[model samples]
Target: MDHRDMRISDAERERVVAQLNTAVAEGRLTIAEFEDRVDGVLRARTFGEIEPYVTDLPVQQVKPPEESELRSRSSSLKRRGRWTVPRRLTIVTLSSSVKLDFTEAIFGAAVVDVVLDAHSSSVELVLPAGAVADVDSIYTHASTVKSRIEPSGGGVQFRISGEVSTSSVKLRYQRRFWRWRW
Candidate 1:
């Protein structure tokens, strides 16, 4: 028979032989069983002939209707203005330490400002005054930063910091669950 007409690549046959040898070495199959399986793989005339050996493994399939419906609904909410994109700006500092200053007017109504200080060895976050004003409760999820909402004269400050090479900051609107990160 022509080598090409056999419909089995040399690499594929070698891989099956290796697997059969390993199975016998591991005592999962007797020498007779291993030889039979290896021969079958080598003699496979079409891809279908190898199906029985691979059927037990999981295979990928298209998503079902119920899953597709849920995905469509979730995407529709984003287009309906339920989520707002927060403004993000990146600033580079050359000084050993830097301080950022801002006021409520810098951010429009219901918008919060987030400042990320990215230094060579440290990172810091500063939240605007109105970020969480309307919320009845406040909880922090990240352990890196020591968060504090303190009355500074007539305004409030939310600050967090840690040792970091680069700083990323996000402005979050609690009620809308909208965020802008930089």
Candidate 2:
């Protein structure tokens, strides 16, 4: 698909930068070239603007996500590994399970907001090291909420707020390589 005209998210730019870094490590790009592309990516505002920087370099499908929302109804959904984190998200799970792992997520913004709505469901948040989460607005009724991470300054901050009804929500920090742990 031609996505050059689409507006690019900061997370998308970061993703391309990471790909460039890998290319340099693999000897596919020189240090100077990588530096130049990196600069271009950070300054890019549109998809077209960043295409040239990674056109010749290897990359995954760089299409920007339409929006930032994951919903499940009586089913299971998981997000992990090399996914792009949107600027804002709204996740709703209805009597289902949803796990959002941000350890390897490409952050699109320095500050992100996540709204979670759970109903008789389980929601798990696996955060990246040095990332902090604030749940001051989270409210629950007859539910279990456990967090292993205390609010603190970190590389990327996720401001979370939501309502849970008869469900469980847990938050923790996990190593990027550890996917088995919930």
Candidate 3:
């Protein structure tokens, strides 16, 4: 089979997702457009199926932020609007809160691994409709986790592993159940 005809890998799909996220982050795409492309990315089986998503976007030469800065903890943090989504993001807090809304935030990968280090703190992630968040493992120590993450059709994959201590880890999905496209 030709290169484009070969089956794609998870990493490849992620790379494409990252690119699509980047395109949206740079104002080249609207949320609806990105969502549509993400659906195509997740369901894509071959490279030929995903090339169209980023064909019109320019290649970014800027390097992503350093690990130290990206992994830093914050208090009362909220990530909204257009922001770059890293491959792996660790949300940490001592005794505060962090809210990440992916409804408008751009994704950097198809399967973004999100680590919630809710140490005496709380973490809330707001995902778009159809997005799936797979809680790989959750550990609660004097904490509570309210997850609305369930398997859904046609969206990105989020692998979540976290420890909640005297804190809460919540995954929220927005959009009416009756309204869906994909």
Best by TM-score: 2
By summed lDDT, the worst window of 10 consecutive residues in model 2 runs over 58-67
The superposed Cα distance between candidate 2 and the true structure at residue 137, in angstroms, equals 0.2
Q: Which tens-of-lDDT digit does each residue in 21-130 have in candidate 1?
A: 76678787788877778778887865567556534433323221221111111111111111222333233332233323232122222333233333331223334444
lDDT of 3 by residue, 142-179 (tens): 88777687777577788888787888788887645567
lDDT of 2 by residue, 8-32 (tens): 9666676788889889989999999
Clash count, one per candidate = 0, 1, 2
TM-score of each: 0.26, 0.64, 0.58
Q: Candidate 2 at residue 76, lDDT?
A: 96
Instruction: List where candidate 2 sits over 4 angstroms from the true fold.
Output: 1-67, 175-182
Give per-residue lDDT, candidate 3, residue 89: 82
Sort all candidates by TM-score, best to worst.
2, 3, 1
